[model samples]
Target: SASETPGKAAVGEENIVKLQHVQDTREFFIEVLEYLPGGNLYQYLEQKEMLDEYTACRVSLRILKALDHLHARRLLHRDVRLQQFILAEPGDPESCKLADLWCLASLPRKKNFMVEEGRPCDLLTAAPEVVKQGEFSAKSDVWAAGCVIFELLHGHPPFGGTGKALVQRICCGEPEFSELGTATGGLSDNAIDLLRWMLQREPGQRPSVHECLKHAWFEGYNVEKPSKQVWQVEKLIRHVKLWGKPPHSRRNLPASNLLASKRGIVTPGFCTYMGATSVDIDFEPCQMCQGVLEVIGKSEEQQSLGSRVWYWVTKCVLSLWGREENPKQIQLKVCVKPGSPWVELGSCTLDDSTALEASIKIDKPIRYVRISLRGNLGGHFGIAVRKVAFYGYQVRQIPIALHLENLKFLRGSRLHTHAQDIHPKEVNARVHKSLQSSLRVGRRIEGTGAKYRVYEDICSGSPHITTAAETPRLKFPQGVVLIGAVLGLRYVSEVPSKESAPPRLRIQIVKEVNAGGDHERRMKKTLLFATEDLTPPSWKANEVLGNGYVDYPVMFSTGIRANGDDRLHLEILFQNFSGTAHVPADLGLSFFYVPELQSPSTSEDEGLWAGCIQSVQSATVESVSLGMRKLLSIWFPFHFPRSFPCDFLLLRFYILQPYILVSLT
Candidate 1:
């Protein structure tokens, strides 16, 4: 090729040219290539001030096409910014080619890669979910491309601020051409529509690169009308409804939080009205936090734990928006029912300067939690909470039928006033405090016909499973002996919060049955058996606790039942060795039943397993708070495919927290 070119010419496997090392034989060398004299998009934009609308459109359209090509090859150009846009040919803006593959990533990457594949830690024109959870895919590239297009049309980036303001603006605000004086700026409605679709806060809602190319904005004269304008309008209405609304404070998930039909539409941001209300002032934009409960007020108005039993609120989170006029002092309390010698569990105070927090933790389960606020020198107004979340379990849900019941309370875990009796009535008069609830938190909660999801088994370290002796002929990955079908169960906390997370603890898995005769029936039936110690013993004393949540995995023997009773009475009993931790009331567990493999049949070649989902039926989910942890188990009759290998099931894990418990500290 060119004799003066700086970059090397490949020589196949022996493709070594004299790599130009930095001066004086330093180890690092640079790959020199023929200099691109045309200059990049940033330089062009600086010289021209702003690109013409058609030229801008053409550039964006070309970039999208190039991106589509990369994405089709399962690659992601994550940093699709101005610097990367190079002239495909000198002096031709229409032929711009994207450059600077700093953050380029291969598609469908691992979820926890953190800083691999050019995923920048800084928020440099990325999607909301990317900023929120380091999640990226082809759609994420589309978002950055949209941002570049926006910057081209206007003279600057759409949401230009520093620090938290920049993140919030990018995540929550809708930039409009109307804001840029659309009449004179002259961006077509189709163009605006395409940009808006690409920049949607929710990644699931955004269009694919192919879909973007098909949008009316790119069609020139063949602009296509959107198929469902009503759907778009409804989405906009939902967004509007979520904002600027008065806080019902202390209200359950009200009508506004849910879509009317049973469709599986999960909207973005916090619509669920959980937590306490701040002062009731009429404001233009809803002071509502995006994904948490609002808990700001002058006087005491704690959340009630419902009219039923005791729930251990393991964690509580308080996300600050900003204080109103009077927010100098903050007092938080967790106490039992009101009486003399008031049974107080814990109390903490927050000053204005050092008050910012993502979560606040408590050791015990208490019915009442009271928050009070006072203002500082300059102003006097109520405390204004942006978001508040909690985690805990009800006392009655523990099912301490006989041996597990505690007649005497531990001194430190004594949020309960009944120091001697476990019955609520004996101490109900003294323990009538406030907690979240015993009712369903979300409508799509189990027993509502929502499809169950298969979650990966979660355990600290590399804990292995041991099955009871039954089908000793069968085996599984990780030395798991086949008993019946091992139920892959994962716990879900409703109001999952960092502070709300209980300390490290063990959970006992047991199956109960009606063993006693009809009239003379006893309480519990031991239909389930464990092959070894209940909790995995390999957990180290100095185990690294997560930012908040931990997964306690349990495996049960599923072989004994012969009556075709698909449902098993699986009971989760939390071990109280660590008094500092309490199971959140919002505890949820899901199970996917996998049948045990049978020994080969009449034919020698007949196998024990298959690849299909035919053997496994519907997965079951039980919410601890709603008391349906046992009876409402799901068991669809789907079976594993008739013929396939049994050992191919690869276990994977997923973390899905409820809407109300997002941490913003």
Candidate 2:
């Protein structure tokens, strides 16, 4: 029913004829295959409204079988639209044959064809990867089949829009189902599912045409017989009815606007052609635009709902292989219109050794264009345009902690002592006075005249010394002495002996104040001491009166005495601290060993018997003023195990004043 005539003026004098390639295709069919011409299914559907299920199935099977044959022969009918099929006889539907080989491109002779990735194309009926990457195989044809099915079921394509918008929707939006549902009175789920499978994004997921024949929707379909002859005749009639009329005359229009004569302008019409030089032309303009000209490239000629168009421009260059001279430059001016923004859009200047590219966008449409070379040109360099499309933007999310400042070790001694003790006198003067006055006043008013007050106390004592008897057993009468200042006690011991014992000592602090007639009482106890030896012993205090200062010393002397001793050894160790902060107390203690008088019988000996204090120090026991409270226990060992007879061991303790304090932020 449909036939094509090229170079003949049957329709109109100015009617555009099919390109030579298309004409050759028609010749191959008519002369070689002896088949009459046929047209597209679009016209057929327009006239009949819709095809019966059996006819639809027959048509689908025929198309698929034909596609399989083409693919097997390594031939690709790139434009697989419904408009390509044609009818052979005027009224015989069974005479319908495949037509419009204009868009067909000979595939590579070898099995391998260079496939580019992420090439943009028509999106509506195109596979996802085809739109993303310009990579395709025979499976791509199956995707076209899905589109064809969609059109058959409905009146229109799945996704329909302008060039850019169509591409956008195809790449980003889902296909419309409402139209198909309405046209077919609701398609079977199996049919819908088959269509979806055929249109999957991945090419490998699409079923082959042969495989499609097995689908449930195509059940009982016949691929050999022309059972849908009436449908084919109707389709041919529709085509003749629609496009059979002569093409519209453009003679009344401006001669300059004619498509053949127009330069740098694409008319608002559809044009399909086959072969490489389908629409090639050259132009020489009097003046050139200062801006850059952008040209888009098309992978295929058929326009689908969503297809991206890419464009590029280049300059011509020439070089001699054996010559080592400088290359000449060509000056070229190009202009691009303001239109839709394009990704990977930019300008480039081509020289002998370098090429540059940039991305750009246009806001308005443009028609007339010109380009000028910057310098003398050896060859021509021009801009090329094509559609480059992509699917979607790749997106990738990445947790983040803030605020940390300082850290320090807590040791109490300025010297070797582990426990630091705070003396009653070192307490915050204000707090000390207030506490002392309160106690003094309270005690005085009560008529109980207490000389000192007990405020805060802590004990740091050794557990090794168990009994009072063992307390003085390890004491050094006239040698080095060890003291625990924080514990407010000294370990009294001498050279090991059968009767030597651990020290039995306790710490007590006294603060004297004038009572007067107010009869007030003030009490403050800063340090406390504990002894492993719990038994009570006779308390003896030795006072060293010097320069109007009274120093009281408690000595736990071992009964054993040594003679001719020249040196003394002392060792000290600290355990742990334990205490409370009600009353601020700090204890500091020192030890001294005195040598006993030499016997008159040995007076002739040159050795001297004397007591010496080699060092002094202080440590922290507790500091109530700084909110730091601790108990420190220390152990001290002294030995003067020589044969020299020693007289006495002197132990001294002092209270240090509190100084620097730290506060939290």
> Where does candidate 2 stray beyond 4 Å?
1-38, 91-95, 105-124, 182-184, 220-665
Give the worst 10-residue stretch by lDDT in candidate 1.
Answer: 230-239
lDDT of 2 by residue, 548-594 (tens): 11111222222212221322222222211111101111122222122
* Alpha carbon deviation, residue 565, candidate 2 (Å): 99
User: Local distance difference test, per candidate?
Assistant: 0.37, 0.32
Compare the candidates by lDDT and give the number of the best one: 1
**TM-score of model 2 vs. true structure:** 0.28
Off by over 4 Å in 1: 1-34, 88-91, 108-124, 181-184, 221-665
Q: Give lDDT: candidate 2, residue 483.
A: 22
The sequence of per-residue lDDT tens digits that candidate 1 reaches over residues 298-338 is 11211111112222344454455443332444444532112
